[model samples]
Target: MANQVVSLSGETTQPSRADVVIIGGGIMGVSIAYHLASAGVRGVVVIERAALGSGSSAKPLGGVRATFSDPANVALGKRSLDAYKRFGEEFGADIGLRQVGYLFLCRSEAEVLDCEASVAVQNSFGSNSRMISGAEAARINPFLDPEVLLAASFSPQDGYAEPSRAVAAYAAAAQAAGVRFLTGTEVLAVETAAGSIRSVTTNRGTIRTDSVICAAGAWSRHVGQMVGVELPVTPVRRQIGMTRQQPQPYPEVPFTLDLSTTMYFHNYGNGMLLGISNQQAPGFGRDFSFEWLGEFNAAARICAPSLAEPDLEFGWAGLYENTPDHNALIGASDEVSGFFYATGFSGHGFLQGPAVGELVRDLYLGRQGFMDVSTFSVTRFHNDDETLVREVHII
Candidate 1:
C-alpha cells in the first residue's frame, strides 16, 4: 500500500512506506531527514501534525551561541555554527543567519567568574568567545544598562537567525535530496512487536518502516506514551512579544540576555523581538493572552526600557519541551528497540537542528561522527544518573 498524503482539510490519499519514519516535521525532524538524504539514504518520510516549523521551532528567540556550561552543548553549538556558516552555499537557501554575536549579561561576581571559565572552555574548543567587563559590554551594546551588570561574555560567532527560513532551508534541501514529507498528519500510535517498532499508525494511515525517530518536540512525551516509555520531556509554556516597526540606530544588535532576570531581546528589522520564560504552570495550551503580554512587557522594560512604550504589537505563547536537565536527549531508547529519540531540546532546537541532523546520520550509519551523545541517552535517566545543566537563562 502506498503512503497516504493527508491535507489539513481532512482529505487523505494512499498510505506510504519508507525505510525510516520520522515522527515530527520540526527543525530536528526535518534536519534529520535532510542529513539522511545527504548520506544517500533514500525512502525517508517526515510526518508533521501541522505546518512545518509551527511547533517550538518557530517560537524560540533563535539564539545560536556556543557559550554553554556543558561540554556536550558546546560541541553541538560549534557543529551547528559550522553548518549555519555553509548553509547558503550548500543548500542554496538563505537561512537569514547573522553573526552579530551574543551578549550574555552577568549580574553577580560569581556569574562573572563562571562566564570567564565558560569562555575559556569555549576558546579551547576553537570558539571565538571571550569575557568582557560591564564597561566594555556597554560599548558593544550601547542600549544596555551597564549599571546593573557586573560583567558579560561576548561571542562574535554566536548570533540569531530566522527560524522559519532555517526550517524552510532544511525542508527544501531534504526535498531536493528525495526525502518525502507528510504534513498535517498526526501520529496516532507506534506499532511495535517483539520490542521493535514495526510501523506508525497515523491519522492518514499506517506507515510501515524499520526505524522510527521521534522528534515530536512538545508532543514528544505524548509520542513516547505510544510505546509505554515515559519521557521526562514536559511542555512548559513560554511567551514572546514583538514591537511595531520603529526605526532604531542599533538595527543589528546581538541577541542580549540578562542572566539575573532571564530576560532576552534581539533586533528584528525595524522593531525588536522580546520574550521571557513564563512563570505560570505548565500546559497553557496555545492561546495568546494579555496576561503573558503583560509579563513580557514588564520583563522587557527591566531589560530594555525602550521597548516598554512600543505599539504593543502583540504576543504569542508556545510550549518549551523541557528535559530533566536543560540539555537535549538525543539517543536510542532502552525500552524500545529500533526506535531513536531526539525530542527534549529545552529551547535550543532551532539553532542545533543542523548538527542534530548530522548526529542522526551518524546514529543511523552506526558511526560516531563528531560528538558522542551517549551521555544524553534515555538509559541514563533509568539508571539514576541525571546530568543536569545549571544554566539560569532558559528563554
Candidate 2:
C-alpha cells in the first residue's frame, strides 16, 4: 500500500490527500514521519497547529536518559539516547547534547532502596547506573547539600539536549524525504466509516487518508474522541525556572534531581535551570504561576540549599500528557483501523521519542518491535484485572 502527499508552492497549503495524516508536528510526529518516509513510505502529511517544535517540544531543555526502573522505559530511553548521540552525525544537526549524566538525590532509607532497585534494573540493561552516597553526589555537583542526602543514583549516559534542534533536524529530514508538513492547521475532526479512518478534517482543509496517526501530545484525548476512541490522556502544566547568569562561573554539572519531590536542577549557560513536579496544579493552562515557586524553593532548600540564593527567572510552562500510570499510550487501535498513536509519555517523551518512532513504524508495518509493546497498549486501562504500568523515576 503506497501513499502520496502533494504540496503546492509553500508549506502553508494543505494537501487534499495523503497516505498518512499525522496530527502534531512535535517530536513524535516528526520522528515518525522521518522513519516512515525513510522506510519508503510516502504521501505522509504532518499537520501542526503551530510552528514545528513550538508546542511542548520547544519547552524544556530535553533530557535523554535510560535510568528507569521499568524495563520497557529503560529500553526505550536507552535506544533513544543512542539515537540522540548519533543525531548530529546522521541528521546533520548539532543538538548540543552534553552527556554530563543524571544524578538523583535520595533523602530517606526507602528512597535509597528504590534508588538501588532502579539502578539494578538500569544496570541489567547495560546502562551502567549505580547507587552512590551523598558525599559522592556532592563531589559530582558542588551545589548539593550532602549532609541531608541518604543515597543517590547516577547514570553516566543520561543527559540533556536541545529539543528544538532535534525537532528541526527530524522535520527537515522527513520533509526532504517527500513528507509534506502543514503548520498552523488544526485537526477539526476525523471522518471514519466501517471501523476505519477515511479522512482527517482540519481547520484549513480536509486530508483524505485512511491512516491517521494521533501524535497530538497533551491534546491527544480530544483528538481520540473525534474517532470514537477514548485515549486516557490529561494535560497537566509543568514549569521550569532559569537563573540569570551567576556572579561566579558555574561548573558543569549532571542533570541533578531530588528523589522525593521530583525537583531537578542542571547547569545551563552561565547559571542553571531548576524545576519541580506540581501535581496540584492541573489542566491545559500554560500560564506561568508564582504560586508553585514557594513549594519548589522549599524542596530546593532541603535538596540543594545553595540554589535558594540565586534569583531565578520563570522559564517555560508546558503540559505533560499524563496517563493514570504516568507511562505512555502507544499502539494501534483494535476497534478503529488505521488509527495509530504514540503519546501520553508524561515527562519522558523527548528521550523516548526516537525509539517510539521505531515502535510506531513497526506497528504500522505489522512487524516486530525491539521491545514488547503489549504492556503499553491503550486498552490496558480498560481492563480491570490488568496491572497498570508506572514509570517511577520521573524528573
Most TM-score-accurate candidate: 2
Q: Please report the candidate that would top lDDT against the real structure.
A: 2
Report every candidate's CA lDDT: 0.78, 0.85
Q: Give the per-residue Cα lDDT of candidate 1 at 379.
A: 60
Count of backbone clashes, every candidate in sequence: 7, 2
Q: What is candidate 1's CA lDDT for residue 392?
A: 37
Model 1 worst lDDT window (10 residues): 1-10
Candidate 1 per-residue C-alpha lDDT over 1-395 given as tens digits, one digit per residue, 9 for 90 to 100:
01112122233342567899898888898899999998999888888878878887765347787778777888898889888889789877776778999998998888888888889889989999888888887788776777777889999998987677777778877877877788878888888898888998888888888888999988888888888787788788877777676755445678888876677778766777776676767773877766665665676566567665557576667778887766788887677887888988888887788898899888988888788888777666676543443353365
Clashes of 1: 7
What are the TM-scores, per candidate, against the unseen true structure?
0.92, 0.95
lDDT of 2 by residue, 1-395 (tens): 00111222454478888999889988899999999998999999998887888778876487899988888889999999999999989988888898999998899899898889989899888898898889999999998888999889999888999887888888888888998988878889999999999999888878899999999999999999999999999888888888887678799899998878888889877878888886755688888766667778888888788887558754777888888888899999998999999999998889999999999988888899898898898988888754664654465
Determine which window of 10 residues in candidate 2 has minimal summed lDDT: 1-10
